[model samples]
Target: MEDRYSAVVDLQGDSKQAAEFSAKNLNKNIMLEVENKDENELVDVVREGYLTTNSGFLKEDVNGGTCCVTALIRKGNLIVSNAGDCRAVMSRNGVAEALTTEEHMDGKANA
Candidate 1:
């Protein structure tokens, strides 16, 4: 998470704040879920963070949206966790490879 994302720099009461909520909480929730030892825990945390943070923003009547990405490299495995439009990509032998494709705000795979 970026330092500026620590909180909403400007209280626009808009989606930017909600996006900050997503980024900040994604950092927090991922740590909370790490102990589950589940392979998909990162992704699950991202999903939960998205909902929980947005819920708070909505409860406060803040408008806007959030998107996030999470990834873990463990035991020689590259795990990609994507939520919203966040994506990951890599290169192999000068070839670019997409780890996750961009999707709509609803969190569905791109068609």
Candidate 2:
């Protein structure tokens, strides 16, 4: 989020192009944070980051970061991304379907 905030800081007057640039850069940064990893891994890494108070609240201390959900809508389709334990569900044909996988949070990880 620091990257996102810093990126848009220069455009404080908030022109249309700046807003668009901010949005796009934020999306790109999110992707950069999780390169080629699966959703569950992302979830665990974020959880671990928050679990660690090691760096004492610095932006670069991403290993001890916060939790968030990232969603983008374009061309009538929604692309959702998440870290930590949030779940996104949809109902179809009177049945509920979870579009995202839930990360286990029982303090147990594979050795």
Candidate 3:
């Protein structure tokens, strides 16, 4: 059996530092807090992860960030969340299924 994990953080405009920080922060929280959590608890963890990352941004930083996270827990449950334009997709039997919707600058879903 093989295990795979993927997470992404993309900052709006440019701020590579912000993106890096958000990614690391989110990954850390997920690694520490997600095990044995239910779906609702997983959502809460993701939301709090975003809040913690956002709180770390400098006051003068105008850049925003997008995040897409996926996790496979025990019992074969997969949890996914998207926090901006970033998206998550799954491939099954040569077909691609979008797991998340993309958000535009106006905060509209680009489905």
Candidate 4:
């Protein structure tokens, strides 16, 4: 079997208190439940992983919201899921590839 890897970044409200709370409650249930290797499964894993890692408190501001970004790398295949403005990108052979599209208030943005 090939090696599998995962990374997560959780960004909460613009205050230290909010960020702290968000990180503390970040769930990791998906990592403990995923087992398939298909594309849909990979996407589901990425989505659930992000949710699990970014659940917590938030601030009361227009731009101050909680967001999570997740990346899953299995051998040469890569999958990513993101919320808010968080982003994930991959580079191969000098070519840049977008792993996760950013979710911004303005719309989807490139990372």
Query: What would the per-residue lDDT of candidate 1 be over residues 17-92, giving only the tens digit for each residue?
Result: 7777767665675566666657645455555655655566678665666555666665565556565656777889
lDDT of 4 by residue, 8-92 (tens): 4444325555455445543344456555556557656655554544432312332245555555566676656666656666789
What TM-scores do the predictions have?
0.60, 0.35, 0.60, 0.49
Superposed model 2: Cα runs more than 4 Å off: 1-65, 103-111
- Comparison by lDDT, 2 against 4, better one: 4
Error of 2 at 69 (Å): 2.3
Model 3 bad stretches (over 4 Å): 1-13, 35-40, 58-68, 72-75, 103-111
Among residues 3 or more apart in sequence or in different chains, the pairs in candidate 3 whose N, CA or C atoms overlap within 3 Å are none
Question: In terms of TM-score, which candidate is stronger, 1 or 4?
Answer: 1
Off by over 4 Å in 1: 1-13, 40-46, 103-111
RMSD for each of the candidates: 10.4, 13.0, 14.4, 15.8
Order of models, best lDDT first? 1, 3, 4, 2
Model 2, 20-107: lDDT tens digits are: 4434444454455455656545544443433332223333322222334455443454555444456676789999987666566454
Q: Candidate 3's residue-wise lDDT over 11-111, tens digit each?
A: 34555666777677766755566676675676666556555556665453567554555454545656666665577788999999988765443532222
Clashes of each: 2, 2, 0, 2
TM-score of 4: 0.49
